[model samples]
Target: MVRLFILLAAVQLVLFVLALISCLSAARVRNAPRLVWVLVILLIPLLGPLAYFLWGRPLPAPEEGTVPRRRRAPSAPDDDPDFLRSVDTEQSRREREALAQWEKELENGEPDKPQGSA
Candidate 1:
């Protein structure tokens, strides 16, 4: 008889703690305010927690009139035509000039050392 009483007390404590935690942490609980739900849980013990779990949980509502967006990987800079076209015109001219200088040096017997590298 004593063992049975201790088991029931443990069950009641578990129910009360679980109910309080669930009530406090829920995104939005049911009709009653959070303060009221908390009071209900504390005052009523086992029944308070059970009632909150059954009726106070938020139900996910589908958003109306919205089209689902398709998830796609972002395009790389090389894959984007707009990004490729956006390269600086001055930079392109500089690259062309450098290439011409390198080719001219290769043809000449005496060549100048490259400027950027020591």
Candidate 2:
């Protein structure tokens, strides 16, 4: 019974150390919320470290080429009627062009470039 108690205490101490280390390491990374990290360390103990292992690492920033700019929200509807009308006109023109091209392709059939065609 005494041996079992000592083993349990040692295991708990190791778990606590692992959790603390993971939490502190995560805190060093920029942009991590400190308060949320502290709560994670205290509330979940063993699982907290594992959770952080899986989710705590920072996500890579969008790469240089082809990454869309992050937008907070869409621009509000334009107040000027003419400006809005111009935007709508531009969009409709593009849509009509796309439809015309698709209709032409449908009439002509697809290009015969698919692989494995004898």
Report the number of backbone clashes for model 1.
0
Off by over 4 Å in 1: 60-118
| Model 2, span 8-107: residue lDDT tens | 8787668667666766765353335756765776788567655655666455567778766675444566766667899999999999999998888788
- List TM-score per model, in order: 0.48, 0.33
RMSD of each: 12.5, 14.4
Where is model 2 more than 4 Å wrong at Cα?
Answer: 27-32, 57-118
Error of 2 at 75 (Å): 50
Task: For candidate 1, list the clashing residue pairs, or say none.
Answer: none
For model 2, what is the alpha-carbon lDDT of residue 47? 73
Q: Weakest 10 consecutive residues, lDDT, candidate 2?
A: 25-34
Q: Residue 27 in candidate 2 has what lDDT?
A: 31
lDDT of each: 0.81, 0.69
Model 1 agreement with the true structure over 61-118: per-residue lDDT tens digits: 6579875556554478877665666675667988999999888888895478767976
